[model samples]
Target: MNDEILVPLDLSDAIAMIDRQKEQIAALTTENERLRKEIKEIKEKIKLTNEYVDKYHGLGDRSLEDARKVEREIALSQSETQWLNR
Candidate 1:
């Protein structure tokens, strides 16, 4: 009768592959959270900028009316001065 021997398989390589996959998943999760925070901050900044622009639009109309009033007063003063000189 002849005898045969069987060798046992090693599982270290499989365990290393699983560890690498876990590391990749962790990295992806961290990157996703960072992107979400950045998006939120950008949206808030846009909202603030829009509000500032709207406020300035109202101020611009008031400034234009004031400038027109000043110009009329200057013109009337110049006309009176010329009449007095004559």
Candidate 2:
């Protein structure tokens, strides 16, 4: 048999905890939005870079590698955003 002890929480303490949780949720929402915006900006930059590389260098090995790196970054950012949404 397992025994469990329940500790009583005061109303003020419960309210404080709720307030702290709200603050944390707000902070996380702000951070998530910021990250999403940053990811959009980065993706736009990557598109421009890809275009320039294609036009000027015809996607040389180094440029191709850089593009792959940007793609990975985008993938990771998207996954993070999805997780945040969940």
TM-score of each: 0.50, 0.55
Writing each residue's lDDT as its tens digit, candidate 2 over 1-86 gives 12222234455678889999999999999999988887887778678767856764665787777777767876787678678766
Model 2, position 46: C-alpha lDDT score: 77
Best by TM-score: 2
**All models: lDDT?**
0.63, 0.75
Off by over 4 Å in 1: 1-10, 58-86
lDDT of 1: 0.63
Per-candidate total of colliding backbone pairs: 0, 0
- TM-score, predicted candidate 1 vs. hidden true structure: 0.50
